[model samples]
Target: MACKVQKRVSLRRRLHILRFLTNSNYNKLKVALENVKREYENLIATRRDYIRLLDNNVNDNKDVKIVKISEGTFMVKVTCEKGGGKLVAILEAFEEICVNVEEAKVSCENEFSMEAIIVSEDQSLDVTYVTEVILKAIEK
Candidate 1:
């Protein structure tokens, strides 16, 4: 009878230890998740600030922005107050410049906006010249 009581006490002690460890682990996981959430929010805020800075530096008069992403890849963005056949015209201009459009996203609701990823075979593709060509196309 004494041995049975001792076994029951030992079992209860072990269960108590297990419950404590489980709670400790749960608390640790909760803290880690909170930290990850904080980092994600900080990242989002930094991105928003970066985008705002870019917007502030942009020339309102010009509706085109072309950035050289890599050696032969360019990211093109165009925004205009008018919407019509601008998409077709811009694609035609890209064809003339001999740049392949790998991906393009266009929004023509109320206004016109286009973002394109262009890959050029010509390593010497001039950004200034491409900007000028796209500007001309937008004007037309």
Candidate 2:
């Protein structure tokens, strides 16, 4: 009976040590994964900042334009156009301007007018700036 009790106590201690080791290893892995994620996010932010700086320096006229023709009616545009051909070209332009656009109702005319209803989440200057950019892009 004494021997059996001693064996059981030994087994319990071994199991406790094993569990502690496993939990410690798991916690380390979790920390490593979190660090990796933070590093990845930092890299992405750096790349984005670099691209923003490049675009600003290279393209002098690239802007978000807005115009208010009347009360409760406005037009907006951005200068981030890409892709191939004219339709694609216009679409790319629209996309470039839309990076900062939160919500908008858009209508495009291949030869005429491109009208849109824009709702911006945050604004530094005014909503009319968005409209001006859109008009300029469409005219181009």
Cα-based TM-score, every candidate: 0.55, 0.41
Per-residue CA lDDT of model 1 for 25-136, tens digit only, reads 9999999999999999999999999998877654344578889999989999988755548888899999998999999898877568889999998889978989999988
Model 2: residues with Cα > 4 Å off, grouped in runs? 61-140
The lDDT for every candidate, in the order shown, is: 0.88, 0.56
lDDT of 2 by residue, 1-140 (tens): 99999999999999999999999999999999999999999999999999999787744544455575344344554443332232444455556654333344433332222334443333443554544544455446
Specify the poorest-scoring 10-residue window by lDDT in model 2. 106-115
Q: CA shift at 5, candidate 2, in angstroms?
A: 1.7
TM-score (C-alpha, index-matched) for candidate 1: 0.55
Q: List the candidate 1 regions with Cα displacement exceeding 4 Å.
A: 1-62
Clashes of each: 0, 24
